[model samples]
Target: MEITMYDKLLQLPLFQGLCQEDFTSILEKVRFEFNKYPAGSCIAQQGKACKQLIFILQGTVYAKSIDNEHGYVLYETFDSPQVIEPYSLFGMFPQYTASYHAQTDISTVSFNKSYVLSELNKYEIFQLNYLNVISNRAQNVYRKLWDTHIGNTAEKITNFLQLRCTKPAGEKTLQIKMEDLATLIDDTRINVSKVLNKFQEEGLIQLKRKEIHIPALEKLIEQYT
Candidate 1:
């Protein structure tokens, strides 16, 4: 693929702060490689080498794996132009716990590992994006450890609920399902159920089956904090 595909990345805050002319040398090294996987096909496997940085240009992908019981848990999803790789990439290590699978017919623009690093050293903008990759991961780690195990079920429910309110153009309704939220929070569905129900009964939230709506944003955040 051509460098034109990366034009979308230019609009990002990290990339917007950059001038294309300044990074022309990097784009010369950047290339898009096409690959197709049918829906439900594993794109990258666990414990394998992650030799490329994939930015899906079309369709959807899933970061998924099974626990001891062998139930397929969808950990995360990636749409077009979104980068998908484990934390090991920044540390320049082998694969991590998760694997990526196509949730639909998909294609991506991959970066040569050496090219990416070369660009990072040559361009400050790419360097910021590189740091961003690690910063986001660190935030995720903190969210997981945030009083979750120490707090009551209601507190845990509130913690996850905060994200819905903060989402870009998010409605009171959380567009995702309880089962998915359970995996993201690393909690059992039963525990998630108990927590949600308790919060709902206390009038902290309004649960309309699959939709978890927050009616009192300020009060809810206060309680969770």
Candidate 2:
């Protein structure tokens, strides 16, 4: 049990920079329990009190919500070695902001809210990582809102490309397929394909079979914003 949990924790970004000795020491003092969920199950529901912080050890899950008009809206999907709803684990109203469903069979370790808060107080690295997770989540929400409300199809594709491209500067390759990219932006695949072609013709992006290479990110970003 110790060996397995230690290896799993090592994969999580929250523990990324910690040495093995430090990780072992921290785990020795913290209390956590694991659970398994079958595929197509709801892991957590919206508006429920967040008593524990769930850390995904394996499999995939999606945080989704419903709208009167749109029905089920997928906010995001997460793969293994990730934390769920770190931002909602605190504050006066510490409740899940969206429902989480297991897209595949999932294994998770949950730390009691009190246990996590206590550990955060004792470890600077953990505290920093916690803050980073929450800050990044907030920024993602802001970006999604901006893209949905203000961005046109071309701008939306460009913004999504920039976020997924993963290069600091200069040319970068996009590995996502057109269908998946369309689903991500909540747009039609035909429109996305057309936009990609337009960008290709303009020399902003080059599309190959199952790959997209951005030549001038500055030009693409200029159009995005």
> Which has the greatest lDDT?
2
Q: What is the lDDT of residue 154 in candidate 1?
A: 58
State the C-alpha lDDT per candidate: 0.62, 0.73
- What tens-digit string does per-residue lDDT give for candidate 1 at 1-225? 345554755644335566656656556666647677789888777667777776666787766543334233324555666666635565656574567788899876566577666664577766777678678766755775675554655566556554322221112445456786687666788888887887788786777756666555556657666
Candidate 1: C-alpha RMSD to true structure equals 6.4
- Candidate 1 clashes: the total is 0
Which has the greatest TM-score?
A: 1
Task: State the weakest 10-residue window (summed lDDT) of model 2.
Answer: 66-75
